[model samples]
Target: MKSTTLSRALLASSIALALAGCNSSNSNDGGGHTLPLEECKTYQSAPEVIVLSDNENIERQTITIGATGDMHGRIFAYDYALDSVDVNAGFTKISTLLSEERAQNPNMIMIDLGDTLQGNSAELFNDLPVHPVVDTMNFMDYDLWVPGNHEFDFERSFLDKNIQAFEQAVISSNIVWDKNSDACATNGEEVPFLPSYQIFEIDGAKVAVVGLTPSWVTNWQASSPQNFRNLDFKNELESVRKAVEDATAKHQPDVVIGALHWGRKDGGTGVHKIATELADYFDVLFMGHEHAQFIERVEKDGDYTADQLNISVRDADGRPQNQVEDKNISERYHSANRHESVKVIEPGSWGWALAKAEIELYKDADGKWQIFDTTLANRTVADIEEDAALQQEMQEIHDASVIDANTQIGTVDGNFTFTGHVSKFGGDEAVHEDPQFDGATNRLYTTIHHAKVADMPLVDFINQTQIRVIEEKATDHNGNPVKVDVSAAALFGDSSNLTDGQVYLKKDSANLYMYDNMLVATEISGEQLQNFMEWSYSYFNTYQEGDITVSFNKDIRAYNYDLFDGQGFTYEVDIAQEPGNRVTITSIRGTEFDKDATYVIAVNDYRFSSTMVPNGWVSEEDELWNSADETVYAIRDMLTEYVAETGTLSAGEFTNQNWHIVQYGQTDAEGNLVGDKGALLKARETEEGSKLWQQLQNKEICVVREESRDSDITIAVNYKDGSTWYENPQPGTYQGCVH
Candidate 1:
């Protein structure tokens, strides 16, 4: 059969229902051949018998598993947001890889680890009878699907429809219906919303695959609990162990696999923990969600911690090379003390690579099939051919998304950039006569580098837009009109910017926002606000007395460095001080700062959940209003609407030089850059200083990597780009200079 849809009722009833104890009451690509859209089924057939043993008594078979995860809706090779061809990743390219694997190893199992539904233009067809991504995967004959955390980003109804619409099985062991929830009544009994594990028989050998999703969806989607209503995400390790045990006891499978939608180490719960703790339970574990690629092996008796065993095996030579040894060699290998081990593999996200694991099974003298050896590798699609059939099938939707991205929504008078930083030496509008600088480029410095030192108009625009929307649409918890007192936002997309005098399109909004975050408003005390500010400013490292350049804390993500701006407040971050004491409120609506004062603030839903809730600065109950209650819920859509209605976006409207950094040695006791070191910092505005600054910034001149005041400084001119020319330079002349 090509592909057939399974009955939703039958599938739900077939799922294991023994996890009642964990219940809680909370609160693909293109078709080479065009397949009919309505049919949902896997074209997986019986394993092609490829014997690996020469001994008549021993019969061996190799099963290859082809898997993809964290695809993020990259079906075509084109990026709708950028209006450019994206050769780096695409499901259409991945389909070519999958087709080859299936032809070479007919016994292959195709799987998607999750985060496949949202991210690109594919989201435009979410309301279709079947999601375009799902339809594509079904057409590709994907056997099993795991629901990822991003899958909960939409409404429950949408998720329900997609789950039922998939031709194959959707499995996740950790997510269960809360028995205590009124929205999901299961006769006072907890029920698995989907099957926990799937058993597939290949050549009379049973293989069971258990799926586990990230259990922190509660905190990640705290702003929109309705999306995951009546569900409680259980502990990852506990759920997987229980599911594995149940699958083993019930089916006595020869192989047990884990399809986890968590990362290897970053997430508190990941395959690292699984490899170290549950190594003996599973034969192999495939993972996703971190958008990483690797293959690893952890011995059951080894003393390896999660960190040591959690490495991603990229090079093929780095892995063990003992697959399908001769019978004589196999006997010798069997005689040695061999410890049982679990194999872990993950395909990088967005269809960049395909993770393939070839497992060798052999029937021993007792006529019982036992796993003998395995090989694992990740095939990147850099040079892979795109499946022409898939491109032909998805052309219409892809073209429509491109047209929508280019459709004019509004106009911009100037550029709004996150990456472009005006250079002080060259002047913001200075044009270079050099051929290399042919583009309409003017940059004195990189804002990302100086973002900690000054307020950015790019960030200001996001915050101002958020504040405006909240003040216009949001209400207090009691449904009373509430004014926004403070607003904060972060720069997520490094290269995103608005062009000067361009007709802004939907893609412009997407490029500027870059995330699906909804707007959120919350009430907080002035003390809480100060604490939040301090935490944000902590992105900067402590400035030592003689430090010439300010460095950032490598541990902190740039996205966590939020810039706060509002009509009611002004603050300064003193890098001269320690992190906890860096921020001081200079003024509050032109009044003395009051730590006890109450105020309303605007932020994205992700910021509310990932930061405010974790810091105890705000709670779900403190929510003044959320965009989830409004028709235009997404921040990107809100930005598009605001621009479209205004007809033009003026940079002056968003510019707010409210917050600034106070450097250490360059400042007076009162924190002004008026000292000798401060003069050196401001020298860029002068003739000589500007010339030297430009040359240094452009690498026309560079300093030796190993330099010190105690030693002769070797200045290498054109160090990076051209022939090296050296000069002996005065040490203190260029000290404290901002590049």
Candidate 2:
């Protein structure tokens, strides 16, 4: 379907897209509106013609197909009883979405690509006779099942035993089993691989699904941290060969589907190339791996045009060659046609997204189901509806995924999730959303809360929202007019790796960085903390003691690699080279009253906090956001409520533009941005020592300085005169240099 059609469809739907809250055009309640693409009244989408202008009448034979990858075992723990009503209710929403779109067109087939196990709540109950996950999935009625690397994680035995888990045709053109054993031989089983193909007759259209799995499973066993077994994963091409030949030889499907268990982004190679080559064997390709890649990156033919990358890859065959990096899964399937590769969809890991394909099955076309038109997208969970039964199952799965031994040493009054606190949504939160709602406008009001625990019936005054500090009119708890910064810091666990709508329990030791500095205070101490914070100079480099005027999320690095460069958070009295590998607990300016006192900090939670870092890093305070509330979920409650009210979420889009962040390749130490027109991203390295180091800078007569004499610190200064002093520097930088 065209973007216009989707956008229009969005306008008609009463359910909200979490990330797209501000973009929703219809204010009134209209959850059921249906308008055709020709008469769409929503925001205009990019011209549909541009999407397929490269092809002629073939463009008419298009189907926008959306498929999701790496679902794992998410569907199973969805309902406790694992009943069809519950499973179908959960899937019904997706089905409803599919049905609505079908009204727009006719042949949209929603495909669940692969990886329907692992991290799934139901995986905990795999030993049960009734596999909740597989059964629910079967009820969902997916078009086909593509084998994932993890499917063989429990050893091939489980796969062999549960081959029937998938209600759809199980296609693993890449996996194999020992002959006549009725079980996937584990630990080097030499059986021939399974037939890699599945033929689908959707709306009377012939679509063949040829599946392939990454050979990387050979190196990584199932849940390596948990001692899951590793099996021999054969070449992706080997299985494709078997499946393709078999499928076409027996029956010529109008459309060939390549459901390879390979990834799209950062999979060492452009999986699209594999898709393209498979395209030579198959008509279309749906790929996985790399945690859901951008739809635009996977080309039907192969590698991007030279103009796009300024380079081209070719093989001995002299055409475009595929480059597989990291010595891993590469172009296993180079197309025989060399022109049509695959239509890949590297969907989000852990069931975060699902892709759907809408095609027209037309006649006068040999009366076969030839694809008439098509497109793909990583559908955001924000636009999704949670099946009530699925929700229950999800909870059970969560309970199962986590080991619930009598290890409950501490009981938090409420539960938590990273989505709420890591990504705040009030004043500053509202301002953050303005770019879409109006990026040019800044009407954000921040409310900061600080409880006076020392004083009973304690002062519950708002800090930024009316705390002991600045006051501003910001979004309230109801998402309406209220008070100051409502920043919440998740008390336990890192919020980075959390899947959509996951409810996490709060432990006493969890924390996040506030303004990117809390992690330093909590996670590191001495030199280690200093080193981490120094890298973060791009964000927390400067701060006046009492200023509360910046967005905390502005300079964060997601996935925990938001490398740090210590800046204003603290001045390191680095004495590493002198006597002791010591650094000082200078300050943590990313919070309310932070940096005022020396603290023992928790790395992640403190930095992500909007309320306060943590008692470990600051003066002790109640770390839990909704501690008094009678909810199992502390941080998780807010998000669940938000979703229940809004029914959608929005993960940021994938883009190559590094506007908020400097391209990693260009940034350098001492804060010099190589190609950014002298943008000193970090403090310039200088000879002038901080006031604390002046004496050392002035006394630099290369005295008989022994490494032991230094006071776990060195004073340094570059004097006005030629003389220079040195307490302890990083060595080799005598006169003066940046640390």
Candidate 3:
């Protein structure tokens, strides 16, 4: 009953709702392989450093301990199907390591800190059994294990079942069980699981092992609230100190061992603080949480004052000193009072290794020595392997779910594995053969290029809504095909210095496909993406380049620089003989669009939620259409697909065209220079300044189709009519028109 409410204190109630209510009846005594777990409080001789009442004159002792973390169901059976996965391998590794150590001295005990469950691909399609993990742990002969935050990701009922399965002590110092509530309590009344701490003795040594877990586990784990109903995770170091104090005053234990799910030393603020601080109270800390290998003591060999006491234990936090702060272990040794300091150990996660400690008595009490009589014994490393018999027994249980590599969620055409950052958006030349660095050649370009590929794709959001354009699930694109969500940002800016007489590659004959555009390059995210968004509307001139007259409905955020005056674009009265396609403003949004009507955004869907465009956006009323989904293709994909099937791409060329740094105006039907045609032409011409111009003449290029078929097309031309030696009807000027 007490432990029930205590567990609730571990997390907020809202979180518990998602994880299922506390006290859900569920137990699987470890794959029907039940073992009688003994709770021992004594060893061969003497109470393992027995804690007596605080008579103000208690002898302090130094002890050794081992630790490991984040085994994550290595020994457990969350999913029983994969033949290659050694579910029970955790037991073999630890047991073997333990056997070898016991032959040497036998005071060492193995500790598992946290994350005993969740995070496996197979757990998705099967009813995960918590017992296999425990069975494996039991095989290793665990001294202590804590319920990690991941265990809470399951429902309260699952936690309950897992708790029942564990024959070992499952400590959660903060979680308090509620006795009054039948649901929270065990059966008719017996509450499930154990209290926070337990005392054990071995080799005539009395050690009190107290368990603790990170309080923040509630934030990430769903079942945290329900499983830990009414439980409270007190400040770790303080709680351990108090618990030790109480135990010493009552039972007089010699040493306090902390089996903490709480681990620090990572980038996180919470874990590191607890480990460094709580070190004072605990003689040995077997920690988990941030998965790291444990060392009885992390030594600084160079320049560090080994004997000097550090003002603060850790670099991250400066928590208030422990209640026994001022009480120095060294000073307490005068007369009957003995001296003792803390020893901490937190080992790595997973079933990778084992942490062990050996506590030895001081050689001479009267000798003046800054160093103690403790040292770290070598740790044990083991591989996760499969037990042949166990594997056979469980073979039928999971055979069907183990999917072949080829049959995994991929398209019939073949799995479209991501090549690199560059291939995703736009295009680059040459290195495309194998952008990934193959170790043989040590070229700096390949090394740097491959290094950038290590970045993972980020899941972006729009006003809290998941951008559904990115396909989250796997399915074949057949019959009426569904297009993958792919979008791009235009790089042209207001102050771009583009001009005419430029060249760009188009399909050689409008039939071949190509991705050889110079302006097109990936690294489309970060600064590049930001620059495009920031100056998105900067160069959008009307018929007149000098006209910098556009109304902003709201203050928009731009990425390149700040919202500068005139956006660095010095447009003048350079009027062209002909006009360019710039929309003439008549009336705008308020009266122009229907109040409740939806708008179709043709740009890389990101523009819908971004602030780059001054046009206030309306949500998609029904279904949004991207031409890639409607029998059309993005310029790059079309080329790739065309190449893949037809064995030939539409002919094209690569060239970096100039941009519109300044605007040029063109005369409209009113015979007046109404918009910036030169700036537009400048950008287009520069874009075509290379082999791209020749490719364009051969008529080979494809672009993302607008949502509407009638959307006016924007194309860049040579501005010079080609000299045709053939029929007069096939004019050379409009030959590369991208209609």
Error of 3 at 104 (Å): 2.6
In candidate 1, what are the lDDT values of residues 172-284, reduced to their tens digit?
88888777776565676657766678877777777788998888788888988877877888888888888898988888887778899987664555677776777777877
Q: Candidate 3 at 563: error in angstroms?
A: 25
Worst 10 residues of 2 by lDDT: 449-458
Question: Native-vs-model 3 lDDT?
Answer: 0.34
Lowest-sum lDDT 10-residue window in model 3: 456-465
Candidates sorted on TM-score, descending:
1, 3, 2
**The candidate that achieves the highest TM-score relative to the unseen native structure:** 1
- Candidate 1 residue 707 C-alpha distance from true site, Å: 26
- The positional error of residue 39 in candidate 1, measured at the CA in angstroms, is 25
Q: Write the per-residue lDDT of candidate 3 for residues 1-739, one digit (tens) a residue.
A: 0011112222223223212311112121222322322121111112323232222232334344555566654442222212233332243455555666656745455566767754322122113343344444554556566777666543355555555555455665654444445444434432323455666654334567776766554433211245344333455656555666666676555556667776443223333454444444455556677553334332222112222232212112221211111223222212122223344554455444556655544324553212234443324342333344444433322332232111221111211112222333211111222121221111111111111111111101110011122222212233232222223323211111111121111111111111111111111222222233234433222233212111111122212111111111111221222212221212112233222332222243223322222232223321233222222223322322333344422111111011122243333221223445445434435533333333433334221112111111122222232221122133332222222
| Per-model TM-score versus the true fold | 0.78, 0.43, 0.44
For each candidate, the alpha-carbon lDDT, in order, equals 0.65, 0.34, 0.34
lDDT of 1 at 210: 91
